[model samples]
Target: MRLDELPLLTVLIVLPLVGAAVVWALPRAARARARTVAVTVSLLELVVAVAAAGAFDTGDAGTHQLLETHPWIPAIGASYAVGVDGVALLLVLLAVVLTPLVLLAADRHQGGTGDRLQHYLALVLVLEAFMVAVFAARDVFLFYVLFEAMLVPVYFLIGAFGGPLGRWAAVKFLVFSLAGGLIMLVAVIALYLQGPGGPQGFLTDNLTGLDLPVVGERLMFLAFFLAFAIKAPMWPVHTWLPDAAQNATAGTSTLLVGVLDKVGTFGMLTLCLPLFPDASRWAAPVIIALAVVSVLYGALLAIGQQDLMRLIAYTSISHFGFIVLGIFAFTSVGVQGSALYMVNHGLSTGALFLVAGFLVARRGSQRIADFGGLQKVTPVLAGTFLVAGLSALSLPGLSTFVSEFLVLVGTFARSRPAAVVAVVGVVLAALYVLITYQRLFTGPVRDELATTRDLSVREVWVVAPLIALMVVFGFYPAPMIDLVREPSLVTLDQVGVPDVPGGTVVDRAADGGTDDGDDEGSTR
Candidate 1:
């Protein structure tokens, strides 16, 4: 079959489902093989994702590629519609790449046979399936279903394999997600009613360009953005993240905070902006303000964190703020940087969690004070942690630095003051990372951890790919840049915002083509 003719996306989605079943069905004698099964399945998923990349055309990255639409629920205008643009494609790839590493790095001997090892691995496989589908879903309702559906595997991952407060964290996460989902459901139904009614009315293409009442438009945008913001876990709605991250296992946190959390900003760029352009523009200033606040707030909190897991979680909040700021900046550079930052943050932060997990596993503690002078005992672990930490701070020449720099440059063009304030976040980032590293790896050697083993070969494998990717992308980011450019332009075009010369944002509706304005939203 031709590349386009092949049901590549369905295969991508179903492969994991099959893998989940296979792993779960393993006999008791063979239950230990669950990790093997999961590893193989995730690697296969990565291969399929790479294949999709090979088949994709970067020059036409703006348009959805590899579409597979089929009627699902005729009554509600829902369909099994899915596709990927450059933005979605990159995120899908990130999900795939990270899954294998997580499975490989998972502590197999923790609970032994009774730990339901099969179940944990199976849930991860299931989460992978949803991760791909949610990013690929072109229909609004399908996207919503996948959006809310993801909470299932993640909920279990935290609850089943987490710490003392695991179940409570899971419940809180569910409550928050369901609350947002319910609100989005109302907006989703209202959205379909406002569209051209038909079997595929809920498709994003069909729903775009709707001329609704001003109040209605903003409300829908608010509902959708609220859902995304909560998922993205921005400022006010971000409380659940630290709790969830703290309770979950390292691998779980890696996927939860690193991969799943990105769905929020992705929704903002793809769904909110394209479908509700005017509302997005109208809400820009307030969103940018919140984004800046999240950046500062998360960083400040990170610097003061005693628990390593919570610190990482807080750092992600700050990173996500940068992402939202970039998306709302309404510049090609900003959006592109935001898009790329999503991938970079996943790599850097995910590795941080994994390495921290390695340390926690050895020392049996997640507290910063629990570790000290480990650089001499476990030089390799110390080194890997440092690399991940430096990446967190967006050290020059790292992959994160490239993305973070782009976001700043792009935002500076539109909102210098906001960008200026965000720079304070950059300074705070350095402090938090350095302080954490100093406490964990420097000073007098801890007598208790004197014999702590360095990273084993398997542990090395888990972080090697992540570290290598960061280094490769750090020096050469052209491929990522190409992937994000077209979609950035597409989002800009859909929002009806003209790129003004000299960093000004020209509102076609507001200025009537004559007046120039900075991102007025940044000020508010």
Candidate 2:
């Protein structure tokens, strides 16, 4: 079959599930074989993702590509529809790319040997399938189903494999996630009730043309936004993250923060703005305010964290603030930057979590004070930590910098005050990362840390892909930017906003001019 004719997305979604089933069906003594099968299957999924990318029409990034559809519930107007826009494609690839690395990282689970290992690997694959499906779902109902279903494997992964606090963390994660899902369910139902009656009512395209009552639209927007914000884990609702991250395995943390949490922002971009344009606009001020608060608040908390995993978790909260900021800025550059940020954050933060996991495994503790002068013994590991930390801080030569710069520049065009305040988070980020590095990797060597070894060959191979992507995308972001541009423009169009010309504010401020008298065309 031709590439476009193939049910490539369905295969991509189902293959991991099939692999999971196979792994579970293996004989009890085939532990090693299970590991091999899991890795091999994950790699195969990655190859499928690449093929999907290869067949994608980059020039037409706004439209969904390689769509597969079938009616599942004609009575309620729902279907098993799947497709990928540029944003969805990139996130789908992120989920596929991270799963194999996470499996490799978790190869030696601290919990069990034979059956437990197989179970853990199987859960990861199942989670991968759900994540891919969440991004690819063309029908809103399908998206919500996949979105809630993803929590199942993650709950098991954390509760079963995480540390002593695992069970509690898992419960907390479930509570928060389920609460969000329930709220979103209300919104989904209300949307359907208000939508044009047809088999396509649940589809995003059909939902976009909806014209709900003014108050109802705002209420629905809140339902969806609250759900996504909790998933995004913004500010006050973000307490579950540090607990979940600290307790879960590094690999679990990687996928949890890197891939799954992104669905929240992805939902915001795909569903919230387009489906409720007026509500989105009405809600932007409050959302942007909370996003800025999350930036500073999360960074401050990261600086105060003693546990490495919690620290990384807090940094993600901070990074997500930037993402939400860009999305709300309602400018093309801001939206595109936010999209790229989703991908780059996955790579950089995934690396950080995995490296920290290695360190914690060696030191038998997550406390920053437990290790001192680790550079003396494990220079390579320290170097890895440093690079990942630099990426977290959006260092000049890393992938994050390009995306973050665009976010700031784009936000500046729309709101100078918000941009300036958000920039403070950058300084705080540097402080947090540097202080953590100094405490953990610098200072005099501790007796306990002296025996710590460098990264294993497997560990090196696992991290190399993430590190390489950081540097590669850092220097050459054109391909990714190109992929995201059209989607960003589409978002702006949906919101009835136009891109504010770059440097308009800067030029005005430099000339000692104000918005009071300048013509709009002159500013453009």
Candidate 3:
């Protein structure tokens, strides 16, 4: 069969589910083979995602591609619909890419329930399928279902397999998520009723640009945005994350914070802006303020955290703040930058969480004060940790720097004061990263951990790809930036926001130059 003819996205979603079922079906005697099976399945899923990317029509990547729709509920205008635009495709790829590495990082000791490795691995695979599905969903109902359903595997991953306080953390995570999901559900039903009633009424394409009532539009927008914000875990609603991170396993935290939380931001761009254009523009100022607060609040809290896991989790809140800020900024560069930031953040933060998990496992503690001077003893572990940390702080040569620079410049072009205020969070970011690094890795060798071992070959394999991608993208972000450009323009067009001459649309009048990079003298 031709690549285009193949149901690649469905397969991408289903393959892991099949893998999960296979994992669960493993006999008691065959439990030991579970890890190998799970890893192999996740790798296959990644291969399929790459194939989909190859077949993707980059020339017109802004529109949904490889779409599949099967009438799921004809009565309410819902369907089993899925597809990916450039940004959605990238996020889907992120989910598949992280699954196997996280699985490989899971050690035998992490098998909390007796012979529960298979169940745990199956849960991971199930979560992977949902992650891909949620990002790829085109039907709002489908998206909402997957959004709430994702909690199942995650709940188990945290509550059953996590650390000492895992149960409490799991309950907290559930409460916050359920509350958000419930609000989004109401918004979804209302949207369906207000939309063209048919088999596919809930499809985003069918609903976009509807002439929603002035008050209703804003209300629904709030309802939908509330769910996303909580999921994004921004500012006031972000309290659940650190606790979950503290109790859950490294792989769980990596996927949960790194990829899952992005659903909220992704929903904003895909649903909020396009579906309620006027309301989005109206609410932009208020949302920007909240996003900036999340940025500073998260970074400040991260600095003060004593637990390494909780600290890393808190940093995600701040990073997400920048993403929401860029999206709400409503400029082409801002939207594009936020999209790229999502992908890059997944890479850097996933690596950081995994490495930190490894360190805690080896040292048998999550407290920052537990050990010091690890660099002299374990150069490799220390080195990888440092690279991940540097990426977190947006060091000039890393992937994050490029995206962050775009966000700030884009925001400045539209909202200079907010941009200026957000920059303080950037300065604070440096302090948390440096202080944590200094306290944990640098001082005189601690007597207790003087003989500590370095990263295992498997651990090195887990981190290498993420670090290499960060370095490569740092130097050449063109490809990544290109992926988001067409979609960014479409988003801005929806919001009726023109790229003010300086950044997004390019200030050819000011510079006396055209967008054609080589034409220094050419102008309109």
Candidate 4:
């Protein structure tokens, strides 16, 4: 690549590190200085991401753009390869967009006169850098490295700044993540052993050639899937999320749930489909069944939650189910819709967290019962919450509704029964979000909460952009579709799914048919 074409990937990864170092070197006494520096760095990263998105060609939707490659471990044939397709670019953009918002949210708690606040700001900046890198890294090892490296900042964020459960929540989060990483490690090693040519080992390039025996592929695929599923926090494995989220401060919860958790779904799309297509095909039914269960289970649990933070946590699991279902469905619309869901979900959910954080700061509690008639005292805040909640529940004209609708439509084209069941999830979501809004915001102001004030100008700034983007993207998603169509096509072929005009539309069981990778929705 020409010097002018130098991959933006390294820039995306490096900018936050530079921001972090600058924050650290600044005098610990300079809390304002550190926050200033961190916010600037995050916004700059956002600009770069937007530029990268502009550079992408919507027409060549499937190709990786702004590519770069350099040999990192010659002996093992591994290289530091990084690039973004439309789907990856969308995720990269979401990470970039949320970083500044996260920093802004963190600023709300920095009002206390303490020098130690600088360290908190610095860690958030460093985490932003790693978050961007995680989405952009094409090399599996590089991806894994960033994945594991990100835990430290968040661990400290929660442990140091969280509520009474800080230490316990942090430890639980790490234990779950580390255990999953080790499982994936073994799979990565096994993949290296099944090298494409000679003993060169498992660089993604080489592994692309060695499809591996079906049995071995299935085993390794499950290993990686297990790790990512936990991160995705799917139904059975999602228990960690509610505790961690509830214990952490709002800013910390925003980043953890908004950007970091997405790493799991990204892995499934970028790694699993290309490396273990056959196994992915073989496990399709079970995965889809699990995804459907998550949708219903999470929604039901979310509806019953008394704590707002935990309610949001359970709701996220439900949202993740939509993304997973889209991926396993294997249709182009399903895959692309899944990717879009990632971005849209980040915006809506992140906004909710920030808004909730504002409430928590005011009332010093997260209990739904602790809030009432917030609409009267804090109408702006209540309105913001309503918008975000509606969007989260996939209200029409919002970004999430478009993606969720497309996902069900795509899945239905292949498996009508599965689509019917998933639609019930939509109704459940509406019930939870609307009822929560009514009970918390519309009722008569309680004596305690009535004293609560509306969001200040600065707090409003923190959430406005996120809510705006949620609406902007909802009505005009065609640009996003054009950008990712090609990549989704490439992934579909990789996973043994044949491409039709919109996506694969199959009439019967996808497994019994020829395994030319057609019938992408085999999981249905």
Which 10 residues in a row give candidate 1 its minimum summed lDDT? 506-515
Give the range where candidate 2 is weakest over 10 consecutive residues by summed lDDT. 506-515
lDDT of 3 by residue, 267-351 (tens): 9999999998878877888888999999999999999999999999999999999999999887778898899999999999999
lDDT of 1 by residue, 1-524 (tens): 87766778889999999999999888888887889989999999998888888888999999999999999998889999999999899999999999999888877533224447778888999999999999999999999999998999999999988988999999999999999999989999898999998999899999999997789989999999999999998999999999999889998999998899999999999999989988888888888889999999999999999999999999999999999999998888989999999999999999999999999889888899899999999999999999999999999878999999989988888777788999999999999999999999998898998999999999999999999999999999999999889999888888877654566644343332233444543212
**Total clashes in model 4, counting residue pairs 3 or more apart in sequence or in different chains:** 6
Candidate 3 stretches greater than 4 Å from native: 503-524
Ranking by lDDT: 1, 2, 3, 4
What tens digits encode model 2's per-residue C-alpha lDDT throughout 180-224? 899889999999999886887798878895768989999999999
TM-score of each: 0.96, 0.96, 0.95, 0.94
lDDT against true structure, model 1: 0.90
lDDT of model 3 at position 190: 88
CA shift at 160, candidate 1, in angstroms?
1.0
Model 4, range 288-314, lDDT digits (tens) per residue?
A: 888889999999999999999999999
Cα-lDDT of candidate 2: 0.90
Candidate 3 residue pairs in backbone clash: none
Off by over 4 Å in 1: 108-115, 501-524
C-alpha-based local distance difference test score of model 4: 0.82
Output the lDDT of residue 458, model 1. 93
Better of 1 and 4 by lDDT: 1
Candidate rank order under TM-score: 1, 2, 3, 4
